[model samples]
Target: MPKEKSLVKNVMYKSLLSLFNIVVPIIIGSYATKIIGKDGMGEVFYADTIYQYFLIFGAFGIYNYGLREISRIRDNKEKLKQLFSSLFILGVASNIIVLLAYAGFIFFNYKGTSSFSIFAIYLFSIFSNLFYVEWANEALEKYDFITIKTIIVKLIYIVALLTLVKTPEDYLIYAGLISVALFLNNIISFVFIVKDIGFTLKCLTFRRHVKYLIMALIMANGNVLYTQLDKLFLGSNLGKDTVAFYTTPQNVVYMINAFIMSVVYVTIPRLSNILAANDEKAYLKLLNKVAKSLSLFLFPAAMGLTVLAREIILLYAKPEFLPAVPVLQIFTIYMITLAFESILSNQVMYVKKREKVLICFIICCGLFNLIAKIGLTKAGLLTPVTAVMTTVMANIILISLEFFYSTRVLKVDIPIFKLDKFKYLFISLLFIPITYGVKMIFASTVMITLVTMILCGSVYFGILLVTKDEVVIAILNKFLKRA
Candidate 1:
């Protein structure tokens, strides 16, 4: 058996990746969007909305299938090589389609292209991503390399976008920067993947894997539905203004959700390897440990933001975006739900058949969300935020069922649903008073925000220490090397 790395290294690496992909990008991107007013910001988002839908279609589930399969058979170098070959060959067809789609978009304004001349940039982005997608660094837990690549990419992105994008009217510059940054990043990642893992072009083949490929495709296509289709529908139905308002919260929620999932993201490949080996004890222990650990980490971020929702909204966003703060707070509740589902969904792909379970789950949820958003919006019963809450609830129900199914398949006891059941009750009973007390001492806006963050985190950790939480004790002992 391959010796797995320790948990601390994995979590640190993934968190670093999250910082590169998220924290830097958002803070920098926010500056640009601020320079462009809400309406101008709205235009960039409109383009983003279009790009996201394309991303969904372009991806076609290859990344997930590739990761899980690679993890399951990491020790078998020959087999892994062939799997990559098959995947790479199949990816070529998808790449061509993506390129043609970009071409059509540029030539005919195929829905949301910036200008006719920037097709080269679009091609560069899609092609580079196609090559990069075949890498299984995420599955194999080489996040040391992943983090490095992410940092380099973000730098390239920030520099190119900021320098070249002189005006909102200069969308071509913006598009080119995005495309080039993605291409360069993916290229760097591709080089490492080839050198490290070896996607031996000759050994790879997918001709006989159509059944598996089709299953992966169904799941991949369905994923687009759960992730991005709503924005497209919103644009078509409610127009650009609604798209702007709806997407603002969605952007923040999605970024936060991605950050929240990084913990589980680091764990899943190991989860897969253990399941594949029939290591029941290891698998169950991993799942339970991961769920609880993530629950604790995510609780503070989610709850902290909800507490400071009004101030946070006013502090960061323009007035037009006030609509998104309450919307975002509602999503804070949904964040926990989405985190649970992401972790459990890994089990679905790992323990059971990923492609099948995901397909059924996303389709049902997507259709329900569409119906819910449409009906509620028409009836004047909800805003986009409220519609999101409805969708979030539906996701919770669906994934909860899948979690149980996977647990039953693995023959493990159900978790206490501790987060849903007692998390809020516990946080409220403990943290609210302390957080409020911190707010009073630091009256300045900047001072309060800074003090609040440090104090809230310190108090939360201290409370966990006092309560004798085993996880806290274990983490502390590991860090202090005093065990």
Candidate 2:
């Protein structure tokens, strides 16, 4: 067997993948928004929000469960094949059922509308997902392959977007392009996964996996309550334009959060492997390392987003999207909250097999989010700003609960309050004034954002270097050696 790659290498590859994911959307969205206008963009994303709910049901928590399970047995070929076959078959069966239900809903409710045509195009995603086994590759730590495949697919997607989507009436074609990209991504992964673990149905047993799958399903839906349901509520209450206002900034926040969480994500399989071997010491050590690294980046990122929320909106969206500026600013809190949440839930709780406890926390928080949004809408107060505020509050509650449960009840020694982390936070706070100074000097939106990012990044890391931060020094040393 080959030796495993270092965590740093995996993280580097994963970060590249996240960066590409970020860049492609920025490119497509920047152009798409200008071309299609807010209503068109809103309509496309609103349909996507509805599609995401059904996608979650069809998925049935398979990706998370499969990633953990496959990581455990990846070295054992027969076991890997057995588990892969069972999960793949199970996913297909569930997706088919969900697809039929989705079709019926579209026919009953959305038929004869533009959204109906969009929904029809999106049905390809459901069919494509039958072969969506990228979780298998992620479990095996194939970030290199995953990264390359995604870059190639997205390049093709961008070309299609630029060529095919020329006018607002082509929004349906835009939606089709997205579904096709997804289809290509999944199909490519399905073709490549056979080399790692070939499919076999001989040893399949569905009964054993059902309980965990159900729990995962519930937890996933609970997650969607806050994440996607906000758009649904906004679209229904305000309009597609409002959904555009809310979604535009939130997507930016999500992109930044994805990049930060890439560190936490690449470690899941490793963390699971360590826990499965009962190495508490190594697990805790690695967990602290991840927390420190996240703090180093998350605080500054949150600060930057809060400080330059206006400039960011100007850069990626039109003047009508300025309403989303405050929404994006408020989402700074959500982004920070979500980064730590990933550590506690994905790293600590899920890796340690405490899914039931985690599930309860998610359900409670999700319910709070749902009820709060509904009450606000009923009271005639659910604007984009209030909607985001509700989400931030819900996430804060969820993360707080997760931290308490993980540290207090589970007796996990998460050093969240370490002084070094606070040092990073304090240094990050300096960006507020520095960014203000830069903005006062530069009237151009492009210059203000560019200079603020460069100045903030340099100062942030320069301070870390001055303080002799080990993580910074280590990463610098690696780059210097490569140079």
Best by lDDT: 2
Poorest 10 consecutive residues by lDDT, candidate 2: 1-10
lDDT of 1: 0.67
Candidate lDDT (C-alpha), each: 0.67, 0.88
Report lDDT (Cα) of residue 13, candidate 2.
91
- Cα lDDT tens digits, model 2, 304-346, are 9999999888888888789989999988888888887888888
Per-residue accuracy of model 1 over 203-251 as CA lDDT, tens digit each: 5556666666666666656535443555565556666565666666666
Candidate 1's error at 326, in angstroms? Answer: 1.1
Which portions of model 2 show Cα errors greater than 4 Å? 1-3
Compared with the true structure, model 2 gives a TM-score of: 0.98
TM-score (C-alpha, index-matched) for candidate 1:
0.89
